[model samples]
Target: MRSRLLRTARCLGRDYTKPSAQALRCSGARWQSTSGREWSTPLAKTLAEAISVTGPLPVAAYMRQCLTSDLGGYYTSHNEGRDVFGQKGDFITSPEISQVFGELVGLWVVAEWMAQGRKSEGVYLMEVGPGRGTLMDDMLRTIRNFPALASSLEAVYLVEASPSLREAQHKLLCGDKPIEEIDIGHQSYSKYADNLKVIWTEDVRFVARDPAKTPFIIAHEFFDALPIHIFQSVPPSQPSAPSEITTPTGKHTLNETARLPRASQTNSWRELLVSPTPPYSNHASLGTPKSQQSSGPPPEFELTVAKASTPHSLYLPETSQRYKALKNSDHAVIEISPESQAYAADFAVRIGGGTAPTPTPSLAATSSSTTTTTTQARPVSSSKPEPVHKPTPSGAALILDYGPPSTIPTNSLRGIKQHRMVSPLSEPGLVDLSADVDFMSLAETAINASEGVEVHGPVEQALFLNAMGIKERAAQLVKRALDRERGASLEKSEGERRKEDLTETVKRIETGWKRLVDRGPQGMGKLYQVMAIVPHVPPKEGEKRRRPVGFGGDIVV
Candidate 1:
């Protein structure tokens, strides 16, 4: 770890000493944005002093500043909505591409509400981190299809933390109906002082309302932005353990060898010790209850034992060589996101009900089979047990991100700048860094927190959209485009001359949508996944969620 850090420092030093063309371009862009003012203002001097004193800040910190800095953060100083679209933006989100994404999402929530028996009388249609309100507009437009749903929607709660983005969202969502704001503690709907039927805020930490009464939620492309902590495994003998100690005889030995039994000869015995510390520790303090700290390691660390071998038996003469070979060979890669789990757990508590064991503890325990022996044997504590799960209002929650059901050997952390891939370690906060989410772990965490909080996906985005009928919708759009093109061609008496142009345009749109759903090489099919969670019973015996025709088993939930 020290060596890696040193190497990184050296590389950074070299890069700084000889700024590349890219850095020059970035500096030129910033200079142009700041007008003719010199770069060395008192504020700039203070920032430089802070950086010099603190060494290098984490990429997450830099990103937070860049995106939300009071005076110069990307969102604060510029019109991000306008800047973050088309060929000029860093990257275009699905909602920015088409209204279909948000419309289908709104419909999905309605389906979830119906599935839960539509019990909530005044449900809140909430969106966390609504980007530019494009989603909200499309969703409300679609909700009008079901007038009852549109009317029942007590409020459109948007939880956004950025003032600039919030203003943008507000502008996009402006309508005759009132809009409300709900702070963490003062959550009454009357705060808006109008006929406000909806609200919006970003991040769950700020919501201050009874989740049970308004159990509908939406989070599109929100989880991906949450900071992630990453750690690479260093061999136990690699001198990276925190508890390093020198032997009394003046000899140094790996900490694991001294602490763990020497008889454990298998290289598989090694486990990467990583903690989901700050930036990744969900919006709660680390000192919170185990349930509240759901985004960290499960209370206990698990260790698996490998098969033992005889000390001197020459079962295999090439033992050391073979051991070395096997040691380098990648086995299982464990990727964990305590943040995602914490969020899911919180969602479960909100929708399913306070971590209370539903009336029939024994029956419910038996049915869910989630209660531990200790929890089953002990009498339920009377004192409202510190909420095991972080609290949130009731609502359907959707997590869409990149990742697979099982772990992969290679790390997924990568950087993106101007829609191009770059090294995560190269430019730090100047680029976006992300890792694939472990949806399976997230589902387990949510279910364990509260029963009947159904976690239905880690489904491929392509499949989810197809299940929601994106393909047919895209085809209709393409047909309309073709028709328009054909009319233009006929008017110009260039029917045959413009045939190729029309075909190419139609192909691009069709191909783009296909790429959006594509999974393998040359497609985003497998790269992005969409997941849905709702308060409801699991599908009945042998029954599965209805998927769109032709998508088949690809849509895993």
Candidate 2:
């Protein structure tokens, strides 16, 4: 039967696809003023072919196809080689908002290096999802201020999937240094110094970092972009459970999924009392109990959740979540991105390198077992690729993004285009889809990798920045502007030109500072968060006291 379906699919419309393909071109376009949610996409057409050969896929499977399909995946197509970030791009990131953001990041990395005994050896500096190279540019320039630290810097690696963005990074990061294209291909690295290599890859494994030297990884607004899945508990099935769960909230995309009109597929919005049957596990629970004041599901209860990358994988309950109260609430929707978890695990293995981790269990998806688990070898595409070489043992990674402190997620997946909210399904590939990062999950994943790793922070971004002297730095910049203006006015020949330059500089610096530390709800100050992964070494008793910089204040997690 499968063979017959495949044979039929090949001949049915191979030549007929072009006429209807525009409606389904799948250009990776961001959501905007458009309303053809039911239109066919090129990717959807492809999926339809597969479905012809197989059958309708689970909600997660459909989403993974739309976002990661090599043919026209959202990130894969480079958003049509259009800038997806900055003033003119689809959305603006924190680094693009101000140079100070990256400057403080650089200071934090250097301070961590210092705390790790100020190693003079080579240091691995890396950033994941480095948009247009602006953040790294600011960071590298700032690091230059400390000659000693800069001298010890061995390599700078960027983990970026888009080729268009990679070109932008190369142009900006190279500066005045003569350009050199040592290697140019689908996945390549540029050589700046004979020993120093600048690598850009969709997967993290290709970049080599000295395990012997301290490693610092920066992931800003990264985890949220990784694929995620959603689930809801329903009343117990009498004879047998239906293939998929359903609810009254109605179906919508959690950003990545292609929403369709199907009663049996999935629902988008968060709704309560989904089912009376309790499937209690460690990782499953009501997220906010302050309002519930109870530990179990209520009568006729339903709760939406995102457990794994695909609906077809195991939703194993775990016990270590810090927000036990949340899981108890009937209204809560629990979310956890196995995609991000797998990436964290892969990174941990590369840096820690103890016993090679047991291969992750492969998933065999089916209609009836959508919520069940079965083991088999899985594709490496869903997770970060393994590193080229076994990584040196000691490393530190800093992940900064907008999200909660805990590993659990509560309706955090969102879609944005032009900095405004849009339906994740409004334009399919034409919008930015993101969700909150589960820091706790990453910490636990890293801890399980090896004994040499430890986790820290997951602190408020506001606190992290203040501890790193952002306030003082902003003030200094303002003062310098005033000083420059005064100095420029006194010059005889170039006074007018100099003052003009200083005026523009002052305006830029002040505006950028205000936007970065703005106190509004949308502002980055408190809305964003930070987390760190470092080598684990027990401090000696009665040792000279010194804390890891940017982590001096009281921490909740």
Best by TM-score: 2
Candidate 1, which segments miss by more than 4 Å at Cα?
1-82, 175-196, 209-211, 238-337, 355-395, 408-410, 425-430, 476-512, 536-557
> What tens-digit string does per-residue lDDT give for candidate 2 at 42-73?
44344444554644343334344344444344
The residue-by-residue lDDT of candidate 1 on 32-132, one tens digit each, is 11223233122222233334333433332333433433334344343333454445766777777666677777777666655445543666667766777
lDDT of each: 0.50, 0.56
Error of 2 at 531 (Å): 0.7
- lDDT of residue 309 for candidate 2: 32
lDDT for model 2 comes to 0.56
TM-score of each: 0.61, 0.69
